[model samples]
Target: MAKSTTQNIRQIITKRFNGFFVIMLGAFGLLLFFLFKVVFVDGPTLKADASSKYLKERSIEAVRGNIYASDGSLLATSLPKYRLGMDFSVFKTSKMRDVFQKNMRPLAEHLSAFYKDRTADEYYYKLKSGFEQRKPYVLINMRLLDFQERKTVLTFPVFKLHPKNPIKTGVVFDKVNVRYAPFGQTAYRTVGYMKDKVRVGLEGAFDKELAGVPGHGIFEKMDKNMWRPLDGNKEILPQRGLDLHTTLDVDIQDIVELALMKSLDAYKGNYATAIVMETATGEIKAISNLMKNEKSPTGYSEFVNYAIEVSENDPGSVFKLPAMMAMLEESHMPLTATVTTGGKYTVYNKTMTDSHDYGTLTAQGVIEHSSNIGTIKLMQRVFGSKPSKWYDYLRNFHMLDPLDFQIKPVTGKPNFNVPAKWDALTYMWTSVGYSSNTSPLHLLSFYNAIANNGYWVQPIIVKNATKGNEVVIDYTQTQKRDSKPICSKETLDKIRIMLKGVVESGTGNNLKGTPYGIAGKTGTAQRRVNGNYIKGTYYVSFIGYFPVNNPKYTMLVAMDKPLGSSEGTYARQVTAPVFKDISDHIYARDMKIQRKLSGYLPDSLNNASLHHLIHPLDHSILYANLGFPRIEEDGRWLSFQLNKKEVKNYGLSFAPKKVANVVGMNLRDALFVLENQGLKVRAQGLGFVQSQSIPAGFPIQKNALITIQLH
Candidate 1:
């Protein structure tokens, strides 16, 4: 009877259990179906806010690329930082009130010391409020905590340290990379800046390659408002930005910046610009713009990029290089051919004037003096009957078009225009660098063509680019070397020789003795503002290169509205010295130029004597109010105060007496002049003047000894 009763009870219990299990399984299936519908189909159909909560995905931050200089020095880079926060409830502190305020005080103090945005009191208030509100996780520092500070915080009692949480914080710093410019504002404008955290300029143009693809990771929001890795997190490896190789040399860039600053400051000018390039390959070595911001007390810091930015009339005589090139290409005239130029001449019944009264001069002489009248005559000879031909010539040289560089131009029309109602003299004016608009880059490129033996290669900023070691730009073996004959080699030779003559005997005479022979032209044009030209405003410029026989570097400088008188003379007077300084500095460094002369210098030094040497052979002696005097056996004392030109010219003079070592006097001034004269100067002192080897009147031969002491 007992067995039977037990069996019946077991059977009844088993059936009930089975029925409950089936019902539970059915309920679970229905719940799963509802979840699927909500996630896939119904989710999208819901209200915007509801849909966002269910369907919107969190973003993975993209990794930024490293920026490098031409030689691969990391200029801009990203560094790692930390993010930290805490879950107020999980900090299991047993000492309740006794330790709560003490621990919290230190934490608040840490926050105060690290972050300047808030005070310790403010941090304490926020922490208290977060606890009162039952906030799950609270953010402390937005960036990485100091290593020492983080360590100290971790040792504190009951501070459940989740390197991801309090002290270190779970805010997910994730070792993110950000952009940094080491040479701050060096080439700031040209390199461009970030917009909304995206790179710009060379960085922006190639952002696609420089900006690496971001990685994704799956994470779940914790109950405490913190994030933790999901059980099976899906992730993608981040791709790094491509490394870019450029043609820019930091040394050359330094010279350009220095010269630009000097020009802007000296003239108290509105703005200034300078560019250096390799003549043969059309590689842009350096480009600088020193503009004046509106608030700038003096007009030397405008955000405008005068190199490519277009405005009417600011680019003064720098336009003449291209204008002259157009005329030369159109009119097959001899360089020595004569043209009559007065101070002003009428063209198409419109009066035009040369910067000076050049009278009758050869075509080459016109360039030497930068004669406006002569240029107009040349234009008339070429395009007077057919104005469109001048345009065609300019088009061939790319003067009327954007350079098509990596950087897009910022400005108006890309062509030089002689309006439909243009007169015969309009072409002449255009030829003389008037009635047109151009960038400093346009003129520099045109001169570069002349230096390149008429070959026009496209100028580029980035030499090569890499994407995960794959060459994107391929500058090394796959260099984009473009070559085309825009003018005859004979034409190039003539122009080059004429330019050398300008430096040798004409307006650019200041360029003589510049170690390497320079072939270039000077330009001075009046500023035309609001339809009328400013009488006194002048843009003085010089564009040329060194070792004219085998042209290497080509440079252009433009200074706007140089103060004082002398219309077109500013370049030859003010800018040419700077040009020489830049040229000599570069040729000495990269080209190994001095190596070729090494053997010769040693030979020259052996012949120089010290005893009979008074006034070091290469030491330029200057007397007050006296321009420059020849240093004979008897040396004249130099004036303490000296201008750049007078002092520079004095250093170029060789001693009339025997060569000796100059061991005393202004070492800084002496070094400046000696370097300019191509003489080596070594110093060992702190102040000015101490002792001497060369007496005041000794003749110091070229490349002679000059040692100075500062007392």
Candidate 2:
């Protein structure tokens, strides 16, 4: 038994020894496999210089797209700019050390001299740090050097001899495209800014189409510890980004920007916004917003794009337009119907008051005068205590919902409380365009509908968008065109007339005699914060359409919290003037509506005031009507419309009487009536008769038609 045990122990020892040897061999083989992956077979790849190293990466950059305006003007564009770099490893030469050092010193010196403030020592240290860090290529400057500076740097001392003569080094430079906006501060808000090397607005919204595809290349590690492109290697070309064309008219944008700036300057406010749109096409001609830095109110300013900025309380009087329209549609109220305003009304414990006591005025006059109490009374008479119809109208008009524009923002959304205790107070305020929120764009669009003859075109800023010279996106006109008329043509016409009257002789009369007739409303809403009204916070706005007779453009100007002003009626004195100034300039210059009127003339000229001419055939003249027969809408007497039968057989040989209600008559008939009425017939050079000395409905008792003339 002992002998057998000894034999087993010896065999076990021999077996163990052999197993240990085999295990050691297997471990060695595994180590060799890892070593092969690192050093020989598919080794860890560190890019190097081609023509020297066995492998390297050659990089090719992609090109970004250009942004163009509606008229093909350059708003933003991308230009090829090079990022200069240096490979100091190439300067690590031992032979001819003096020559290499000499060449490099001058190159660094030249760079420092040209860049000013950047010395040779600083650049050298930065390059050395890059080398020590084992960086593949060191960036000396990024987005550096405009076109001229870059050209100058390329021709600098020994730098020009680089990658060629003096040092025979491997300091490679690369070029890439970078976006640039020429009109830096203008319309920056609407155009937006870039983040994380990516653009927004027209640049970012269309980034995928605007950003080009990246390319790939091979680089080899060379002998001088540098990377160089491989010669004649296969290349994958990058796709160029598509150019984008937008419907933003540059000229109109300038006008809008200027107007907003002027309004903000005059009002001394926190911010202001304005937008203009073509009444017929729903095309946004221009949009501008100014945001004042609250910290530095007077010195620092920015564009806030207040049109879409929704953080404002709903306007009070301006909202009355739609409220009255809804009431007219539902109740068919006559324009001449009378409403009594005791100056205030109480509903559900809440009291609403008018700006002033406009007691027992016609409905049309209430609108022209912008009576808050009048509108509430109208709503109560029509909707009664039922709040459902008011809300239904709001929904039908899409006023209750938030707008979805290109930017993701919290600016303009209406807020209404809904918790079962819905009352008449809410409906009353809603009738006057308050108790909810609205964007300037929203109000402008509503007025645009009235001006568009009841066709509600959805207001859009981006009229047409193109990708790489191809149209990729465009908005359709408002879907409300096919729907039922929100207001009857007759009601709309009456409202238009009233709106014009407002500018002519009502609350908005400050804008009268403007180059184009303005038809819209004014608004001043007290801002509420945290369930309480802010005493000093008010939103003042003027929403109107130009050329009211045949609507062309509708614009809205809003001033948010205009500081240092006691009267909130600043909307007319401040906002309305902006619309007037811009409309006059745009209509005359771009639209070619009428010849430019002499800037030196006054609206009301006396007989002593010589005839101011706007065109060749017309002259400004004043006359008194001798008798009342008939008149036309264009301020011309309709003497031709009257005949011998109408005149009767008067032996006194009475001349044809010029009608004193000479409103809306053509120039030809007006001249005839003025001549026949024993009054001097003079024509103001061609345009619609926008103003007159005598108000309509007033007889020419004493030379009342004396100031009648075409605009």
Candidate 3:
């Protein structure tokens, strides 16, 4: 009975064990089927989902273009700056904690000594707390550090200890770009800026070219808050914008600005503007616009570009050029035609006046005297039969058109449209520059046209745009705007003659004794305030070119509401003197003008000594070669006095004349004198001597250095 019971138990155990094995096999088969389905059908979707969560897209900013002066000096550029911060998470480890605690005090003291902005105790506690809290980033300072400063900070106690090894001290830097002007406030407006998403000046106008195209890249998440750029197939390199070469002459611009500022300070004017342009090319060399600062009653600073923007009033007597041109072209009137003025004269209901009483004068004389009544009489006599002809002349001269400059913030346009209701006195007012509104630039363009022999070329502020060293856009190489001649050559010549007379004997007479001849007009007109003429407020202006026989530059200077005595309020007093000052300065400095003046000398002696005394042989050779009247002088030393008529000679009594007045001499002459006395010369600047380190008449030292300043 016991053997039978044992066999039955063994059979039952076998059956149960077999059943459990079958169930396990079925479960394994089901799992394999699901794995195959997922791998084939859902792989792409799952991978995309993972990428969406972990991948990042980043933008790479392109480098903006630079602005350069005509001579290739940097005007505006972008500089990269960095903000330094520390990652305190590295100090979380016990080892790092011990190291940090050991160096904490020294690091804090070093930072305090270097930055001098915070106490050591304060820095120590702040840094220690940041480390304890395991902060990722703690700012080193509120102020962003430059590259050199950042490099210097890397040498500090803790920062220098570990760079690649973040466990010692974690350092981080965020880069930023800032616009920098090497020449601050010099042509600031013309160089321009972007503010509140709006572009101003050249920056605004050529933004498309200046702002380079942006690029893109892909990055992958490496940690909870850290992202690293993918190794390959991730980045698009950004392109740099092209550079701009402007027509501005920095030296001339500075001179013009200083001269304008001086006049503004002297007259206490509301504002002043001056522009210098190349006569034939219409390239603007220098432009300055300054306004008196109300807060600082005696100081003046740059405000709006008054030369090309402000157009509230009719140009004063400067408009006389256009009126005179109209009469000369339309009426075929000779410049000799006469008009009489007795201080005041009337046209219809309006009475015009001259500053001084002139009984009768030629049309040329009328312009020279700047007589409103005389100018009106001539215009009426010429344009009375057909008034519209006068307006047509102005239109043809381009006085009614926009300058269409390439600069941003477009230049202001003049209003020369005919009135709906033409009155009898309309011609009279417009003839004397009282009815229409125009900017100083507009007036300058017209005068430049006259100097250009009646051909009107558009004024250009920028010359070209370049990428790297290659020129991408050259304004001069592009198709030039068609220049129209405003009048016959003969008429233009006559106008030029009259303009010269104005400088020689008329309104601009104060500029007559200038080193070079100037031909221009002086304008004085009452400025209108709130649509009413203000008695004391006036616009005084002088516009002309130098070396009258062969014009090279045309300039315009205008002062608004100049305050002072009557004489100071006149154009000759306020603006003419400024013009003279600038012209004299330019004549002394411009290499082209100097070369032209040098051409007056014989070619054989073109590089002759500029010393006070020349060798007698040189004098004879210069006179014989150039056909100048020769003077018989037996003296060992000869001095030359150059006049328009002849080069005369005066014998110098040489007896080691103790360095007489070398302060105002030219560099070459100063050097010649100083070196002749066995002294070494070291000079700064390019023009006449302004100051000397060694006093004149001091006993000379052998080969001693003498410093001289020129301007």
Candidate 4:
């Protein structure tokens, strides 16, 4: 009976064990099926999801290219700057605790002295509190510091504990780029800037070339929400932008700006513009556009490019050149052909007059004297027979179209078509610089054409563009925009001769006494407002070239709303002098012009008159040799006060043993001293020296080129 009962219990136990084993096997099989599905069917999707959370694609900004002047001087560039930070958590470490205790006070004091914006005690408390709180990152300086400054901060007391190890030093830096201009406010408009995503000047025109391609890189998320480049990740290197080599000559630009500013100030003008261009190549050497600031009592700043942009009004007497060219070519009229001008003459019920009256004048005298009546009468005689011929002449000269310059937009397309109400009066009005709209640049191009012997070349501002050392765009090699001969060489020569007469003895006679010959026209036009001529407001201008024997440069100076009496507002009085000032300075300082002068003078006498030129150090020697008495001394540098036959030296001394302070010396005196010191000079602008590359009292290096800026 006992054996039978034990057997029944064992059977029950075995049955229960077998059922549990079967359930366990079924569960294991289901787990294997799900694992296989996950490994094969959903593997890529899950892996991608995980990677997205840990890795990110980031942009690597390209380094912007530099803008350089024609001579390779840096105009605009990008520099790297840094904002400094500190990890106060470093002081919580046991090793840093001793360093903090020993140098905390000294570090605070150094911070106070270095930045000068906070107190030592305040800095100490702030640093101590940050360390106690275990602050991960604390700003050390709000103002961004340069690379050198960042490196310097690394040498500061507590930061110096680990000289070469960044992690140990606990110093942090955020790097950024900054656009820098080496020449402040010089050609600021032309150099341009990016505002509201819109580029201006060269920066805007060549944005694609100047702004390089952006690259891509992989970054991994790090502690404190920081993102850093992941080790072994691929990166596409960014391409640096191409550099721009503009046609601007910094020295000539300085001169043009100074001359324009002086004229604007002297005349109290609302605005002024000046441009200088190479006649043969059409390369713009210098350009200036200045406007009066309404907010300041004595502030003038650059606003827009008026030389190329403003083209709403008639160009005044400067237009006479084109009219004269047309008449000479079509009519075959001699320049000596005579006409009568008795103060004024009537034309188609309208009256025209000259500034002054002459009994009888030739066609050449008409332009020379800027006689409106004479020009109208010549136009009537030449084109009145066939009125369409005048329009055809202007069309052939390309005066009816835009110049289409690459640098700036040009306005003012002339309308030579006859109006419905047109009559003989229209011809007369358009003949003497009225009833036609043009810009100063357009008029300059006309005069430049004459200088180029009738071939009109399009003006160019940018010379070329380069990537690294390879040129990507060569403007010189591009298709030339030069026009076919606008007229025969004979007509060009005749008009040029007449223009010379104007400068020599006619309206531009104020420029007659200059050492070099000037050939240009003076213009005084009534400013039109709301389609009506405004009284007493005029646009005064002078346009021409120098050394008429061989034309090299063509310049234009125009002033709008010059504040003065009627006589003071004339082109001869206001604009011609500015031209003379620029021309005289360029003639004296330009090495090319100097070389040209060398060919004219005999070799033996090339520098003969140089000694007569005064020198500060040689004052005593010069006066004693000339049998004059020594004068009083007031300063180290000597100057002379000449009154009649009496000559007196006012405290003149010898040349400075070291580099002298020539910041206020005139061009002539500055050139003498600098050249006498055996230093090569590069001078800009026309006036007293405003700045010098080499500071005063530095040892002069032989043959070193010193740049002097005048204003």
Comparing 2 with 4 on lDDT, the higher-scoring candidate is: 4
Per-model TM-score, in order, reads 0.71, 0.71, 0.74, 0.74
Candidate 2 Cα RMSD after full superposition onto the native fold (Å): 18.8
Measured with C-alpha atoms, the lDDT of residue 236 in candidate 2 is: 88
Candidate 4: lDDT of 598?
Answer: 35
lDDT of 2 by residue, 204-285 (tens): 5667766678677786663344455665888788777776665566656666766676567667767777788888876777
Residue-level lDDT of model 4, residues 340-389, one tens digit each, is 88788875577777778877899999889998888888888888877677
Q: Write the per-residue lDDT of candidate 1 for residues 1-91, one digit (tens) a residue.
A: 9999999999999999999999999999999999999888787677656534433334456766666666665556665544556555543
lDDT for 430 (candidate 3): 84
RMSD of each: 14.2, 18.8, 12.0, 9.8
Put the candidates in lDDT order, highest first: 3, 4, 2, 1
Clashing pairs in 3: none
- What TM-score would you give candidate 2 relative to the actual structure? 0.71
**Cα lDDT of all candidates, in order?**
0.63, 0.64, 0.77, 0.77
Off by over 4 Å in 3: 1-58, 89-97, 113-117, 162-169, 218-233, 293-299, 478-480, 595-711
